[model samples]
Target: MADEITASDQIDEITDQQFLRAVTSFEAIIVSQIQVKNKLGDRLNNAIRAGIIILGIIAVSLLILLLTLSSQIGRISNVVGAMNQDFSTVSVQMSEIDTAMISMELRMKLLEGIAGQTQVMDQEVVAITADLETMRGTMAGIKSSVKGVRGNISNIAVSIDHMNVNVQQMGYDMQRMGRSARSLNKIFPFPLEY
Candidate 1:
């Protein structure tokens, strides 16, 4: 009976020590789990911050691109407007050229009439040679015809002067147009040979 009681007391002591060891192991496991959770949370926070920074960088880049494009468009519009004014000037010059051409045509017709009159005077001089009795009257007619021809020549000189002035103005306008075109070529996507 004494040996059985001592065995029973030893068994109770072993059970109490086993229960203490199990409780300590459970607490250690809980502490380790909390540490892992804290590390994971820190990693998630870092990833979120990195993503936000990248998004901000992208947004700023897009804004700069947009502003540059807008400025370029505005400059193009101004250039186009200036070209329109140049074209308008060219149109007016063309009209002036047309007027000059019409005046030249009228002068050419007058010259043709003068040539006919000179042919008539030649015939009259031949008649004067053949008939010496009408020489005085023939001389008077020739003198008046010469004076008319001199007046016609003076008018022709004035008309030619006007035509020259108009032509020079047209040339000036063409040069201005070329300058505008050169400026406009800078904006083209491809290189211009001219």
Candidate 2:
């Protein structure tokens, strides 16, 4: 009877110590779960902060790119203005060329008119030369006719002087014969003289 009572008391003490160990183990498990949850929350917060910083950097870069694009657009506008000025200058030069061409065409027409006048003058000169040659031929014929008339008049004058000399000698002979006949009538009688 004494040994059975001692065995029952040792079994009760063992049950009480096992109960305390089980309670301490349950509290330790709950603490470890809380620490794990807190660590996970801190990591999530850090990740969110990193994401926000990256987004800010991207937005600022996009703003800078937009500003650069605007600057380039301003430069392009200036270049376009310069090109417009060049085009206007070219148009003015083309207009000047057109005016010069018109002037040249007018000058060419004037030259053509002058050439026509020159041709008419050349024809007039040729006609004048032909008329002068005809006048010279007429003058030469008149000179030849005058010379022939002078030669004919000189020959007629020579023939008339020769006939005048023969008439004078015959008149002298007739005078001598009339004187002889008078002398013979005086020698004959008074009747012959009467």
In Å, residue 123's CA in model 1 sits off its true spot by 26
lDDT at 53, model 1 = 62
The digit string of per-residue lDDT tens for model 1 on 27-59 reads 999999999999978865865675576557556
5 in model 1: Cα distance from truth in Å?
4.9
| Regions of candidate 2 where Cα sits further than 4 Å from its true position | 1-12, 115-194
Candidate 2 has what TM-score?
Answer: 0.51
TM-score of 1: 0.53
Prediction RMSDs, each to the true structure: 22.7, 71.5
Candidate 2: the clashing residue pairs are none
Full-model lDDT for every candidate: 0.61, 0.59
Which consecutive 10 residues in model 1 have the weakest lDDT in total? 128-137
Worst 10 residues of 2 by lDDT: 185-194
